[model samples]
Target: MAELLDNDDPRFAFAALKEYAANSGALLRSHIEAFGFSGLETVELDVNAAKGLGTLLASKRYAGLVLDRYYAHAAAKWLAAHPTLGRLTERAARSGAVDLLLREGDGTLTGDDLAQEILEDVLRTHAPNLTCRTALILVDPPASDAAAAQRERARSLRASLRALGIETALRVVDANRPGISLPEAPAAEPDLLLNASVFGTDAVFSDEPLFCERCEAAIPSENVEPKSAGGQRLPEPRLLVETAARPLRSHLLIEARRRGIPAVSGFELEVARARAVIEAFLGRPLRNCVSATIERDIRLEAENIVLIGMPGCGKTTIGKILAQRLMRRFVDVDELVAQHVGKFKARIYREEGEAFFREKETEAIRTLALKTGLIISTGGGSCLRPVNRALLGLNGRFIWLKRPLAKLATRDRPIAIARGVAALYEERAPIYSSLADRTIEVSSIDETVRAILGEHA
Candidate 1:
């Protein structure tokens, strides 16, 4: 984070990350939230593809990372062929654990520097929408023999997060073993025992907490989102969570629920502290810090979604479908001009010349971009104007609905006439690529609409 990009392509990391996030929603969301965030949503960035996400939210918000061992070591091992690691990477690639998010470095930095980068990124997004009372952390799966060294790195991260007004915890756990153990409850028996029988009798004995060699998966949590994959009800937060303390440390934590609390896993504690920080920063209770997914009596606000493409690339056709799906009105700039000027689009192009038409097109795109949130489609050349590109980029996302020229055979935009039809494809493809958060390859209006909604929905 302290060093600038040594190359001209500074957005390299951002671009790589956007692609990962776009495709792997479940993984990205889980890892980011685990790092301590109030809320997060992925967006198409005009930044680097290989870039990692870093935000300094408002003062008092918690920000940090919950990383795995693979992220810490793969860079040192695989020099040429490695991407960042995490749930998304695990599910998507499934080959190895690599860093899905990494700063621009030799990838051989000391753990302290790696920890610094993680804290910096999360804190960058921590203001206004976030409160300053947050902390960041770096979680590593137990891998290194140097436990003391790892602890020092974690300590450095904790100090940094605290400097940003966050309380932090760094942990390393053995993924292959039962998680770290703590003291027992007063009366409630430990769900996990080093070696216990079903009837609470000793099956076998060991100094370690009992872990079943037979069971493959960790027990599910009842309240975790999307429910359990096995559909089994999750037991209450026991073992790791204390039932004796006031105000729950977890399992649907709320100030009102704090009572007879117990211990919590490092991950759970980091999350709890992060949320608490957000609440304090916002001057609201922790219960109110997180956003709700439920629409809950929400009123629809008119929105503007402007589609920008070179020319004749199915903007009108796709725009109509997207608007219908969104239940918002649609306006095609070329069609709107034809309707207002009492002339066909081609007629206006021929009679008024390209310059005059471009002026009108620019004004229409500008106005449409500003109007609350209606969906608007622009002509192929609309993106040639920087204003149009900025409007689409800043106000909302840009979807470059495209296909091979073979797929666009009969499409007719102005560029089709002045130059050969192939020329249109050659000229605008790069700009379209630059302008879009995603380039959905579609052969028709319907497919294009589906792709757009697929991401937005």
Candidate 2:
């Protein structure tokens, strides 16, 4: 396994990212943090609205590299090495690499839980970039107790940032779950060695590998079976001492002298974060960032953040974090259902038709502009209608709440209904994305919260 690097080193991956973009007309929008050096401009890309980075790529001569969004490490390496596909990317570069990165190529929506069907459709049939140089990589927890016990038994994101009270700072690992090891010899070393989020999981990528105490022995669900893909029994670590002891001790030593965090590994952190999520789901009081108030006016100073995403993506929880971090109030539109219909929000969905819920949602949308110092969380359906979106955009900073549809299994919200959840998510995702001024995928409540406060995210 590769090792994750600390930020102390000059982040060189981004330098390569910039060089590639400058060599060609391409520009990239990705979760991987850009370094201190500012490029030409920092404009938001509408990932939910459209597809086809070729035309976009053709437009710029700068050679910027987009962070591989969806695929895992093996896929990135394979695509990077493809003979014909690799040539096409080079041709695009020769043609004067106009576009840099396709931000949302990882999932359908950029950072929002907006529409993905159209974008996915285009990618499936028309994508020339599918086998391009960019590839998404996986960095999952190990199938062991180490994976489970660290950071209060939480995964990477939840463990590290949550302890710091960084709520909105959800971790977007560069590598995907059940991580793929990088192949020897392909592209040279990266210019910018930026590890976007603290850990490298399915949510993101980095030049170095990430270490999480939790992943040492925790086999991913897909790989839980004893039989391997090659018709053989796969190796399983019987003890943390053998599989994880060395790695854990090695990283632990570095962290101790360099920057030892309270958690065991990044993956362990995610599991620990479940505490905060559970608290939010139960409507518990929120925590503060350190003792100091960023500014009481932070709430007043904060522009409205309109959350858009598929169902069960933690919009409300993230909203709560943003509100707390900014020292503002939090609002969940679903909470109003009980006030409006004399029934709990879920019961309202059960008794009153979804249409009735929409009607009430519209009412909530209209009320946003009149208020300030509030972080508003809305239902996935709320962003579907143009009228509701218009109301949300009025002096609001539209943000997409992106998360894998699969993670819903761990959540207990009403939106976690089993059947057709993906379909419903597909239907509403694009609409939510269309309205977002900025998009951010919610990997964990901690990472999401950290982002709101403008920390290491």
Model 2 spans with C-alpha error above 4 angstroms: 1-302, 409-419, 455-457
Q: Write the per-residue lDDT of candidate 1 for residues 100-173, one digit (tens) a residue.
A: 33222333211112224333344444333333243322233435433433444444444554555554333233
lDDT of 2 by residue, 1-457 (tens): 0122122332122212222333211222111212112232332232221232333333333233332122112222333444333322332222211112322322211111001111222223323322321212122244432222221112222222223232211112223333433432222321111122223111112223333332342211211322223210111111111011111122222222223222232212211222222222223422444102322222224346667777777888788877776666788877765676678777776777677887787776666643544678887677766555544543356678788877754343555464467777777767666556677877668977676556312
lDDT of 2 at 193: 16
lDDT of 1: 0.40
Candidate 1, RMSD to the unseen true structure? 22.6
Q: Which residue runs of candidate 1 sit more than 4 Å off their true CA positions?
A: 1-303, 409-414
Predicted model with the maximum TM-score: 1
Error of 2 at 127 (Å): 43
